[model samples]
Target chain A: MRKNRSPKPPEPCLLTECMQVIAGAWAPNVIWSLRAGPRRFNELKTDIPPVSSKVLSARLSELEERGVLVRHVRPTSPPSVEYELTALGEELIPALEAIVEVGHKLKQLRGYEPASEAAE
Target chain B: MRKNRSPKPPEPCLLTECMQVIAGAWAPNVIWSLRAGPRRFNELKTDIPPVSSKVLSARLSELEERGVLVRHVRPTSPPSVEYELTALGEELIPALEAIVEVGHKLKQLRGYEPASEAAE
Candidate 1:
């Protein structure tokens, strides 16, 4: 009896491990929005208009827990809060850019309307 | 009255669109497993041992529907079947590679065990 033990690419688990990092409702969006710089909670809302306050709040906390981002509290007249990517989080930008590139092609192939608002 | 409409990076939506492609249980694993070449159903199951047969089957169909892969049937004795990435699907490789790159860093920063089984 032979068990089919053919060689497997080692990336399955690694890819999955990373995928989990960006794997929540609007998690990728949050990261993409912050790629430029830090932003307040309301700024994130404007950046991703579709995300609800509840989901955004949860995703922000999760990202902080993962060390992908950090929250800074400014001692302003009213303690203003902002979120920014850690160095580790910055590493994800190239990955997200690659995804956006494919996204353009996928949109074309799938016959979806091109996003008129793409900043590029 | 000022409505904060600061210049926002436009990639948030694009990133979300692409993330949808790899968003599912073992979806990225299926793509990563097939990256080297085509494989049969059982081979995929073998490549990702933790994936259930049901989830694997479902992921295969979903990927097919997304045009990330193609299904081929061989007119062999028992009519064997294989699946492979299409050209568009091949485009996702670099994206996944970038993600894997970040995965390594992320694992390190989080002090998680280096994936002992990494193919390197």
Candidate 2:
């Protein structure tokens, strides 16, 4: 018996289309950071250490244009801007979670140590 | 009340770790092709049109090195070469399936036409 997922193969175009959504430096990281809740600009940068403000700003704009996320100008005294995932953006979390699960296993298989729990 | 997957955010390194596993030009395509079953060199090339032979060969070698897939030299009359996913590679299928699912929706959401059923 074959151990494949489906009897027919998946179309390559589908994968390419989806990869482009998450493609780019720290794009996934940006999305992942917002997985928990809406985050302000500084919060996002803090969650993803070592990401320069310029690149982070650029990625936020790109994601917003892609409709994966939305920017809200909060009515705070200083008018804080927060980013949150759109419905489509929320759907990508499971896919990313699955990838993280596999990547953890792959890292151990390849003899690389997994990083300690960081979200605590 | 947040509409997020977890109360705690996912570790960024985990996503990065997994992304690296599928990183590189056409690497996901290589893995996606092998998802259905093992494929010969020419079969793979045909599956993904416009991919240069040099790039495809490099991808296979890299995937092999990363423990994602294995290459077998079939002891046929001319010794055919074939590539297939390993256990770890197989684990990535669901993640990719998720991606393809989101991608299909993303294409439509972005007002782009989805390619007609090609695998039918």
Q: Quick one: best lDDT, which candidate?
A: 1
* Candidate number of the best TM-score: 1
DockQ versus reference, model 1: 0.44
Per-residue lDDT, model 2, residue B48, is: 81
**What is candidate 2's lDDT per residue for B5-117, written digit by digit as tens?**
33546478888888877888888888898888888888888778878999999999878877788899989888889899988789888889888888777766666422223
| Model 1 vs. true fold: TM | 0.83
Task: Note the chain A TM-score of all models in turn.
Answer: 0.84, 0.82
C-alpha lDDT of residue A45 in model 2: 84
Error of 2 at B37 (Å): 1.7
Q: Residue by residue across A1-120, what tens digits does model 1's lDDT show?
A: 335444667566777788888778888888888888888998898888999999999999888777678999999887878999988788888888988988887877666532223424
Give the alpha carbon lDDT tens digit for every residue of A21-107 in model 2. Answer: 787778999999888888888888877887899999999987877778999998988898999998778878888888888777776
Q: Mark the regions of model 2 whose C-alpha exceeds 4 Å error after superposition.
A: A1-8, A74-79, A111-120, B1-10, B75-79, B111-120
**How far off is residue A40 in model 1, in Å?**
1.1
